[model samples]
Target: MKKNEVPQDGDNLVKGESNWLNYAVDQNGEYVQEISVGWEPENIALEQAWEVVNEKVEEARTKVLGGQLSPIAFYMEVNIMDIPLLANYMDKYQWQVRRHLQPDIFKQLSEETLDKYAYVFKISRTELMNVPTNKNTK
Candidate 1:
């Protein structure tokens, strides 16, 4: 589908500007430099994919608010990462990652460790500390 047909919805995966190669001839019928353009396609599959993501986010929010899991664990769930995956990303052992899921242990993490987790989650340490409240659950 053409770029004009791309959907603009809450579930849209491609919301902002994107690049696409254009191969159209110039007015003089000569090939010009390829220009960047915005392009995206509306697909039901992508919409459904976001639905699953939202469900997981909700679940994580619930767990965090209920005190069943720590804020870090909630972020892990929202980011769709398991303990093993996060451990591999952080270059720590799986047991270390699991221990960090405990509220007591997470609270004692050093600034460097917090920075590592924040970097992986693409959030700041402050944001990581502020777990989503129940009211903000979406």
Candidate 2:
């Protein structure tokens, strides 16, 4: 298919925004520069992605309410980060991050450690200490 032509229905590239290479010719028939024309297809992939995120958030919320997971775990799920990724972002070891996932351990964290986590999560220490009951509140 030509670069300038949009894909028909059921094409593989129909999921998200796509770039089309466009070209023009001068009066003397000299080839001019090309530009990428961007366009988005009509699709529900974005909605589906959001649904998955929401589902994860709900799962985390359940764990937090059940006392099986710490508030930190809920925030991590809300931010769509796993233990290793969050540990890397906070520059802490994986074991330390895992420990923090325990409510007892999280409550015992030093103010400095709490500050570091708050910085990474972009929230105040108070908010981190008090996990919201509803994900929508965040």
Question: What TM-score does structure 2 among the candidates reach?
Answer: 0.69
Model 2 CA deviation exceeding 4 Å by range? 1-42
**Alpha-carbon RMSD to native, per candidate:** 5.4, 5.7
Error of 2 at 100 (Å): 0.5
Report lDDT per candidate.
0.73, 0.76
lDDT, residue 45, candidate 2: 67
Cα deviation at 25, candidate 1, in Å, is: 21
Winning candidate number (lDDT): 2
In model 1, what lDDT does residue 78 have?
68
Per-model TM-score, in order, reads 0.63, 0.69
Q: Model 2: per-residue lDDT, tens digit, 1-138?
A: 233343333434344344444565655665555544333343356456777888988888898888988888888988889999999999999999999989889889999999988888899999888777766885
